[model samples]
Target chain A: MSGPARTPAEPATAPALEARELEVRFPAGRGRWARAVDGVSLAVRPGQVVALVGESGCGKSTLARALLGLQPVHAGQVLVDGAPLAASRAGLKAYRRRAQLVLQDPMGSLNPRMSVYESVAEGLRIHGVGDEERRVAEALGRVGLRPPERFFARYPHELSGGQRQRVVIAGALVLEPSILVADEPVSSLDASVRGEILALLLRLREELGLSLLVVTHDLGLAWNIADRIAVMYLGRIIEEGSTDEVLGEPKHPYTRALLSVVPEVGRLEPVVLTGEPPDPAAIPAGCRFHPRCPLLRSGLPDEVVTRCHGRALPVLPVQGPHRAACHATDRASADS
Target chain B: MGPGARYALRSVASGLGTLLFVVVFNFFLFRMLPGDPIGLYTRGRNVPPEQIEALRAELDRPLLEQFVTYLANPFASTINSARYNQPVWTLIGDRVWATLLLVGTAIVLASILGTWIGIRAGWRRGERFDRVSTGVTLTLYSMPEFWLGMILLITFGVGVGFVPGVFPIGGIITPGVDPTSLAGVLDVMWHMVLPVTTLMVVYLAEYALVMRASLIDELGEDYLTVARAKGLMDKVVRRRHAVPNALLPTVTLILLNLGFVVSGAITVETVFSWPGLGLLSYDALRGPDIALLQAIFLLFSIGVIVANIIADLLYAVLDPRVRA
Candidate 1:
C-alpha cells in the first residue's frame, strides 16, 4: 500500500526513456496532414511511473507509439539513457529488447492460435536467447500466473479477460526490458480487474526497477499510480508536473475541466465546457483551446483575453517543477 | 469421447446418410426417363424373338425386386453397356485411374502455386506485385473453365506457325508405347500436359483469389501488429503469425474442391478426349444408358461425401477452436 520513494528534483540517474519535441503526422486525404502528435516533449525517469492523460484523439496513443519507435517520427528525437535512439536495424532490435510495449484490449492483442508458452517465449525466440523454458516460466510467475506449466498449453481464448491481460504482460516482461510503455493497459478490462493489473505494474516497477510510461484518460488511475502527470490537449501537453501539484492545483482550464468530472467528496460542480472536441486536422487559430476555454467565457482581463484569441502558445518550459501554457495562468502568476 | 472424435463421428455419419440417399435416388432417376430399358439396351442388335422375350422377362421385373437386387450389390447389379457389352463397373474401373491422375496432379500443383501467390500478394498489399497478381487472378477466375480449356487446346495442342504441336492433341497416351514401361509413363505425362494445364489454370485462379482475400482479412488482425512489435523480422511476422491463421478459410475451400476431383471436369475431358470417367459419362448420356448412368452417379456421390468427411476431420486438426 505504501508509495515508492519520491523522485528527487535532480535525480542522479538519467531518464530511462525520453521524447524531445516529438511530432507525428498522417496524411489527411487530399494533400493536408493531420498532426497527430505535434511538438511534445516528456521524460520517464528510471523506476518512475509517468502517466500521459488526455481525452480520446488527443494523440496520447500516437505519442506512445512514437516513443517505442513503432511509428516513424516526423521531427524531434527519442533518447535512451541520455543518448538518441540508434538508427540501424541491429540497434533498433537491441533497443526493442531493452524496451517493450503492452497494448490495450488484451483480448485482441494476444494471438488466439498461440499457446501461453509460445506467446511468452516469442521475444526470446526472436532475439535468439537461450534457456527459454526457464525464462518463460519465470515471466509467467512474475505476472502471478502460478505454476506456469499449467498455463503453458492454454490459449488466449481459454483464459479470462484479466488472465489474458496478464499473459500479455508476461509476454512483454519475458524479455526483461528496462522500461515498459503500456498504452491504456487496463482500459478494456472489467472495472473489478483494473486495480489488480495496475498494482501488478507498480509491483513490477518496485521489484525490477522498471520504468513505466502509462497512457490513459482516467485521472483516478494517474492519481493512484503515476509519480508525475502530463495532461495533453490537441496533440500538445498543456500542463505537466508532479501528480500532487497538477491535480491539487490545476492551472489550465482544460485540465481543470477534466479534473472537475472526477467524482469526489464535497468538490465543486463539474465544469461542462460547450464545444466540439478539437480536430487535429484543423486546429483553431491562436491558442488551440481558446474556442473551448471556459475562462475566456468567464471574463479574463482585456489584454490577456486578446492574447488568448490572437497568439499561439509555446511548448512547456523545461526549467519549472510545474508548468502550464495559458495566458490567464501567466497573468495570475504575474499578479501574485 | 473427445470433442474431435465426436465431431468426426457426426460428420462421417451424415456423409454416409447422404451417400445412401444418393444410392436410392440414382436407381429411380434413370427409370423415370420415359424410355424402355430393353429398347435402349438392345438398340441395333439382331436377336431372336424368344431371346428378346427372355431379356424382357429378366429386366422387366417388379420395381421392388429390382430395388432389392440393386440394394444387394449396387455396382455389380448394373446391366452390361450397349456399346461395349461390358459390365458398367469394369468400364468405370478402367477410367478411374486416368481421371485421378489428371485431377489429382492439377489440384496439388494449383494449391501450392496459388497459396504462395496469395501469401506474397496479400502481405505486400497495394504494391505493384499485389495489384498485378490480384487483377490477373481475378480475371482468370471469372473466365469460363471450358473456354480457357479450349484456348489451351488450340494454342498448345495443335501446331501454329513456327511452333510445332508440343504436346499430343488428345488421348491419355500414344498407341505404340509399352503400357508398363517408363517410356509409357513419360508419354502419359506428356499427353497430360495440356489437359492438366487447363484444369490448373481454372483451379489456380480460385485458390489464389480466395487465399488473397482471406490473408487480407488476417492482415488487419491485432496479432500481426503484436508480432511485428516483438522485434521479429517482417517476413517472420507474415509467415509465422499471419499466414497460419489466414490459411484456415482457404484450407476449407481447397478440401471442398478436392471433393469434386472424382466427378472430373466433363467439358474439359470431352474437349481433350481424355479416356476418363468424364468422357465415359459424356458417352453414356448419348445412349441414355440407364444402368451405367446410375452406377456413375453413385460413384460421384460417394467421392464427394467421403471428401466432406475428410474435410471436417482435417479442419478440426488445423484449427484448435474447431476441436472444442
Candidate 2:
C-alpha cells in the first residue's frame, strides 16, 4: 500500500529532496565570494512537512532557491528521489514540475493582467496537460476556492487578499507536484487569513500525500504545522528533529533562544541574545555563532572558551532523531 | 448608466472639451502672430492699386467677426489663402494624405520592430543581445531627426549617387510621371525610403526603450518566478506572462505618438522637400498664412482627441483594474 516496501538495505526511502553541502555564493568584491548559502545539507522525506526556520539575511531564502534549481549552485548538489538533478534545460524543466514554489506575497505572485482561470491553467498549458478545464477547476477547488467556475473569469484585483493567495496556491497545486517549497506563505497574509491558508495546505497534504518544505521566520508557524523543524543560523542548520523533540528540548543555543521567545503564560523568561548575527561576508574563524554565544559570556574555562574560537561546529546526532551542532553540547554530554 | 459606460462617457466628454479649448486657443495664437497674411504674401510684388484695395477689403475684418466666420463655416472657402488663392481646407486636404502615408507607415514599422526587440532584450537582461540592442536604440533615440534625414539625403542623393541621382531629391513623385501609373507609385516609394528611415529609427527607439524598461520591471515581479516554477518553458513564460503586462504602457505611448503623426515631421519633410502638412506649414509660417495655420491646428487637435478616446477605451479593455 505504501508503494514498494522500502528495504533497510536500500538506505530507507529516498528523500523527496536532499541537499548535500549545497553552497550558493554571490560575488562580494573582485574575486571574493559572499557565501550566501554556506556548505549546508538537509532533506525532506515523503509526505512530511519540514520547516527551515531562520531570520532575514540568514540565507534561508537563497537555500530554498537553490533547492528548486532556480538559481545556480557554486558547489555541492541537490538530489530528488536520491538522484542528483541534471543541469540541462529539459532536466530542470522536468524537475520543476515535480517541485513547485509558492512565494510570500499573493498579490505580487499573481499576474494582475490574467484571469483566475488563466493563472491556474498556465502550468497545465505549459506542460501540455490535457483536460485543462477539469484540472484547473480541480486545483482551485482543492485550495478551497469552491465552484471554481465563479472565479475563472475574475481578475486578480477583483479578489480579496485571501482569495488571491488561494489563486496563487491553486496555480502551484495545478502542477500536482510531490514537493511544494512555500517561502513564508502566510507572512504576507492577514492574521485571520493566515490560518485558513495554512489549514488548506495541511488538508492538501493529507489528501494528496504531498510533501512540503516550508521556509519561514515564525517559530509559531513551525509549531502549528511542521512535522520536522530545521533551525537555520547564518547559512547552516544548527539544530533539527521532530517538532515535539526539538521544541520540547532544544539543544543548540540558537534553538533554545528561539524557543524561549515563544509567548506562553508562566513560561520561562527568554534568553535574549545580544547583538546582530555576524555578517556572512566576514564569518568568524570558529563556531560562527560564538561571537554572540550566550554560553561564552556565562563564564567557562579559558581553554574551553579558546576552543569555541578555534574549533568549527560539526553536525552530530544526539538522542533518537534529534541533531545539533554546538561544541558546548558535545562537551557537556561527554562530561555527563 | 453603469460605471463602465459612465467612465467612457466621461472620457469622451473631457476629450471634446479639450478640442474646444484648442480651437479657441489656436485662433488667438495665430492672430497674435506678427504681420498680415496679405502683406506677407504680396511682399516685393508690384500689385495694381485697385487690386491691393480689393485684397485689403476682403482680409481686414475685426477679430471677433473673423472667429465667428471660422466657427460657422470652417470648411467653407470664406478664409482666402493669399499664398494658394483658395480656401485653407483645400490646401491642407491636398497635403494630408502624403503626411498620413509617411507617418502611418513609420509608426507601424517602428512599433512592431521596437516592441519585438524590447521583449527579447528584457527577457534576457544583461546578456550580449540586451546590452547591444539597448545601446543602439538609445543612440538612435538621441539623434536629431533633421540631421539624420539630411545625412541620408547627402549619402544617397548626392554623395555616392548609388542610384546615380535617380532618387528624387525633392517632392513625393517624379515631375513628369503619370500620377496614376505604376511608375508614379514606385517613384513615390523610392523618395519615401530616406525620410521614412529617418522617422522610423527615431520613433523605434522610444518604443524599444519603453518596452525594455517596463518588461525589466515586470520580470522582477513574483508572478514570473511562480511561472518558472510551474515548469513553463522560458519562452512561454515570457510570451504569455511577461509581455502582456509590459505591453500596457507601450500601447499608450504608440497611440500618443500616432496622434502627433497628423502634425507631421516638420523638419524631416522640410529637408526632403516632401509635399506634406509639415512642408505646407513651414511655407505658411514663412508667408504668415494665418488661414492655413488655423486649419492645420484644428486638424491636429481633432487627431489628438480621437487618439485620446481610443487609448482610454483600449486601456480599459486591456487592464481590468481600469475597467470600472
Candidate 3:
C-alpha cells in the first residue's frame, strides 16, 4: 500500500492540530454532569496519522468533535500550529477551512437533495472562493471520482456506500485543509469497501502531506494505518504509544483486555472482564478501570492493591513517546 | 419514456378516472333523493295542466336515457335550474369570479405568512417566540371557521362604540359605481376585507402548524449538522439546506387547499353575505335546487382531482428520490 515511512519517535516540527486537557460535559437531568470527555491531551504532528481507539461510549467520538472545534469544550484549549484556537466567528471559519471533519455515516452526512458538485462546492462557496468549477472537479478527481462531470449531478442515493464516502472526503478536501479528522470513516461501509476507503485515505495523506486524526474502535485499523494509538476508557486516556509498543507490550489492564480480542494469529486466550462497561456519569473511585481491572483480581501485592482501590492516577504527560496511566506500571518503573 | 414523463402521465390518467366516477355519482345523487323535482318547483303557484305535463316530461324520463343525455354534455346550457328558471351554468359563471377572487387572495396570503412563521417557530423551538406563536396558532386552528367569521363580521362590519365600521357590511360591491372602473375594483377588495381575513386566519394557523412540525423533524437530520460544519452562516444553512427539504410535505398540503378554492369557504361566505359560489350553494339548498347542486358538486370533485395530480407532479420535481 506504500504507507508513509514515518518513525515512532516524537517529531521536532509543531503539531498540525493539538488538544490540551480538553473536557466536554453534558447535563444528566439533575445537578450532576456526565463527563463525556475529560482532560484529554493529544496531538497530531505534521503529516502524521494518530488513531484514537476505544469501545463505544468511551468518549472517543466526543473527543474528536472537541478537537474539530465543533463541540464546545468546558475546559482546556485546542491549539492549531501552536496557537490557541480563536473563539471569534471569522477565526473559527478560517480554522474550519484549514481542518475539516469527515463524519462516520456518509449517507447521513451528505444532503440527499444536493448533487455531488453542489455538496463538494459548499465549503468554497461559503468562503467566497472563486473558480468553483475547476476546484470542485480537481477535488473530485483527487478522491478517485474520475471524469468528475459524470457524477456532478448525481444524488446521494444513486451512489454506492464507498462512492458516497469518497464524495464526503472530496467535500472536505476541496477546502485544501492541512488536517482531516475522520470519525469512524469506514465503519459504516461494507467489509469489502472498508479497505478501499481506508486505502484512499492513506493515499490522500501521502499525496497531500495532510495530517489525519482517525477515531475508531478497531485496533486492527490502528495497526494498519496509524503511527500512534491512544486508548481511552471512561472519558480518560488510560494508555497511549506507538502502535507497535502499545500493541506488543500493553501496560494497562484495559488495553490488554482490548488487544486480547483483536483476532490475530496465535493470539492468547481472550480475557473477558466480568462487569458492565464503565459509565462516564458514575466513574469508579481510585482507578476508573479498577472495577474491571483483571490485575486487581490476579492477586497483586497488598500495598499496590490498596493504592489501586483508593488513589486516582495523574494525567499522562503531553510529550511522552510511550505512556500508560496505571499504578502497577508506575511501581514497575520505580523498581526498574 | 423518462421517469418524469411517466409519472406525469400516470397522474393525469388517474385524475381523469376519478373525474368520470364523480360525474356518474353527481347524476344519480339528486335522482335518488325523496322529493319530486316537479312538486318541489311548483309548490305555491297554480299552474296549467299542460305546463305541469311539460315539467314532468323534461325531468321524469327513463333513468338510463337521462343518464346518457347528462353524461353527453354535463354543462349543456339547456339544463335549466328548477328554482331560478335560468340556465345552470349561467348562474354558476356569474358567482365563479367572486369566489375565486376572495379564496385566491386568502390562500396566497395564508400560505406565505404561515410558512414564514412556521419556519422561524420550528427552528427555535422551546424558546419564547416559538412557544407563544405555537400557542396562538393552535388556538386559531381549533376555533370554528363560522364562529370566527361571525366575530369578524360583527366587530368590523358593525362597530360597537367609538370604533366605526369602516368596511361595507355585505355584498361584493357598492351600489351605483361604474362596475368596470378602477373605483369598482377597489370597492370589491374593500368588501372582501372581512371574509378574506376570516379565511386567512383559520388557514394560516393550519399551514404554520404543519410547517413547524415538518421543519422540527428536519432539524435533527445529519445533513443540517454537516452544513453547519461546512462553515456556512447559520441562516444560509437553514434556508438552503433545512427549509427546502422541509417544504416537501407542505407543498402537498398547500396544493390540496388550492383544490378547495372552487368550493370556496361556505360558512365564511354565508356569514359575510358575500355573493360567491358558497353563498349560492347555501341559497340553493333552500329549494334543494337539484341541477345547480349537481353542477357545483361535480366542480368541487374535479377541483380536488386536478389538485392531487398537480401535487404529485410538484412533489416529484422538488424531491428527486420520489422520481426514482
Best by lDDT: 3
Which portions of model 3 miss their true places by more than 4 Å? Answer: A1-6, A264-284, A290-310, A328-336, B41-52, B58-60, B77-79, B160-169, B177-179
Candidates sorted on lDDT, descending = 3, 1, 2
Fnat, 2 decimals, each candidate: 0.47, 0.82, 0.55
Worst 10 residues of 3 chain B by lDDT: B76-85
Worst 10 residues of 1 chain A by lDDT: A1-10
Q: Candidate 1: which stretches are off by over 4 Å?
A: A1-10, A263-278, A294-306, A317-320, A330-336, B28-69, B82-84, B159-165
Docking class of 1: medium
Per-residue accuracy of model 2 over B247-311 as CA lDDT, tens digit each: 99999999998898889999999999989999988988777777777788788889988998999
Model 1 Cα shift for residue B274 (angstroms) = 2.1
RMSD of 1: 3.1
**Model 2 chain A: lowest-lDDT 10 consecutive positions:** A1-10
Per-residue accuracy of model 3 over A1-336 as CA lDDT, tens digit each: 233465656778878898888899998877888999988888898888998999999999999888877789999989999999999999989988889889889998898889999999999998889999999999999999999999999999999999999999999999999999999999999999998899998998889989999999998888788888899988888888887788888888888888888885227569998876778888888888888889888888888887788888777766476888888875533232
lDDT of 2 at A228: 82
Residue pairs that clash (backbone atoms under 3 angstroms), model 1: none
Compose the digit string of candidate 1's lDDT tens values, residues A210-263: 999999999878878888889999888889888888888888889899998987
- In angstroms, give how far residue B228 of model 2 lies from its true place: 1.2
